[model samples]
Structure formats: structure tokens, C-alpha cells
Target: MKTLYLVRHAKSSWKFDVIDHERPLNERGLEDGPKMAAHIAAIMPKPDLLMSSDALRAKTTAVFFAKAFTIPDTEIKLNHKMYDFEGRDLVEVIKSVGDEVDTLMVFGHNNAMTNFVNSYGDLRVDNVATAAFTAITFEIHSWQDLIPGKTIYHKAPKEL
Candidate 1:
């Protein structure tokens, strides 16, 4: 079985003069990112791979989880494809994952995250809030054969 963990990037600050991709996390985002990461670390297994959008907000949010998971900087991969908001690129990224990876974690934006999770998981979530985490297990052996299995867990920062 393969386990997939989907994390929505933390709330970003629009107050910055930077472009959307370069915008950093807001105050609430900084607080919630670590909080949610710590909460998930207590329950979930360490991921075999960690992937995140190259965008600043997503990368910053991922850093918290990386610390919590004790994942080295070299182990975390930043992908421009994951920056997609439609979730199609996200799906492509998932399908490309090697079988050697048993558990995979990805941090990105939403409604893509929400759409992706609801598409393959048994659970139906209206939205994936910032710093939200969702885990789903697939019965298939290959990432290319992804099919709905079980919605193992879902956690939002506010719920922590």
C-alpha cells in the first residue's frame, strides 16, 4: 500500500510588495505551520519523500514539516509543477513517483489540494484550510494506478 499526505500551504501575506509566488507567510501562517506539523508528526509515519511547490509560501510551510519530520534539506524537493492551482500538475507529479517510495508528502496550494484529496480519498472535504493535512492510502502497487482506498486522517490547524 502507498500512503499520500497532502498539505495545504499556510496563509500567505498579501501585504508584501512581492509577486504572488514570492509572497511569504503571514503571522498566522508562521504560527500554524509549525503547530500543524508538530501535530501530524505525533501521529503519522515519517514520509519516504517530501515534495513542495517552489513558491515561497509553500516552501516556508514545508520547512516546518521538514523540521518536524527531521528531513534533511537535501531530501526535500521543490517542484515548479506543484505550484499549479488546478491540481492536474499535482496529479502528474504523483503518477511519476517511484514505487520505492512508500509514503509521500506534498505541500501545495488549494483548491488544488482540496480537489486532489477529495478525488482519490474516501472522505469529502469542502475545503482544505491553510496548514491543513490529509492522508490517504491506496491499494494499488504503483503511483500510476492510484485509486480511492481509505481516508486515513485529516487535520486542520484550527482543530489542533
Candidate 2:
């Protein structure tokens, strides 16, 4: 079975005068990002790929997991598509990942993340809070087969 880890970016700081894309993670987010990454390391198999939104908060969150998982920085891809609030776009991105990768992690924002999990993930969860993670296992051989109720585990940061 293939596994997909959907993680929401850590809490962000509004104090930044920069653009939304440039906003950084708050103190809580800094602490929680690595904590959740360590939590992920303690349980799931190391991720083969880490896809993230171009936003700084998302990239920072992904970085923690990349380091904890020992996945090379080259394996992480930052995409602007994820910055948009379309869950389908995220799904398409996953589907397009080469079939060679079996386990993938995506660090992104909510509304899209929550919507994707609720639609494609088997678990019936509400919001995937900041630094939260949900693991979905699928029977399909490729990412294209993802569907609701296909997920087997939904783990949030709080749960960790």
C-alpha cells in the first residue's frame, strides 16, 4: 500500500510586514514543526518525497521533516500551485509525482489540506491544525487511485 502524509504548515506570524508568502513561522510554529517531525519519525516510515507550498511557513515545516527523515534537500520541491487554495490542484500534484515514490509528504495550508483529507482520506477529521499530520494508506499502485475512505490513519500534531 502507498502512504500519503498530509501536514498543515506550522502556525504563522502576522507580525511580518512582508507579503503573505514571505510571512515566517511564529514561535509556536518553530517549536511545533520539529516536534511534529520527530513525532512522524517515531512512527511512520521515512518519507521518500516532501512537497511543500512556496510560502515560508510551509517550507520551514517541510524542512524539519526533511531533516528528521534524512531525505535529501533535493527531494523537496517547492511549488506555487500549492499556494493557491485548490485541493484538486494539490491532488493533481501528488498524482503527477513519479510512480517510483511510494511514500510522500505534503506540507501546505488549510481549507485545501482539510478539504483534501476530508475528501480523499479515509478518516473523518475536521481541521488539520497547524503542525498537524494525517496519514492515508491506499490500495492502489499509483497516486491516481486516491479516493475518500482510502486513508487508514489520521494523526494530528496534538495526537502526536
| lDDT (Cα, tens digit) per residue for candidate 1, span 58-143 | 99988999999898756789999999898999999999999999999999999789899888899999999999999999998899
Clashing pairs in 1: none
Give Cα distance to truth, residue 111, candidate 2, Å.
0.6
**TM-score (all chains, Cα) for each model:** 0.98, 0.93
Model 1 bad stretches (over 4 Å): none
Candidate 1 at 87: error in angstroms?
A: 0.7
Model 2 segments more than 4 A misplaced: none
lDDT of 2 by residue, 1-160 (tens): 6888988999999997999999999999999899989888888898888999999999999999998888876678999888857687898888888778898899888888989988877677778789988888877787777655476666666676
lDDT comparing candidate 2 with the true structure: 0.85
Clash totals in order: 0, 2
Instruction: Give Cα distance to truth, residue 149, candidate 1, Å.
Output: 2.4
TM-score of 2: 0.93
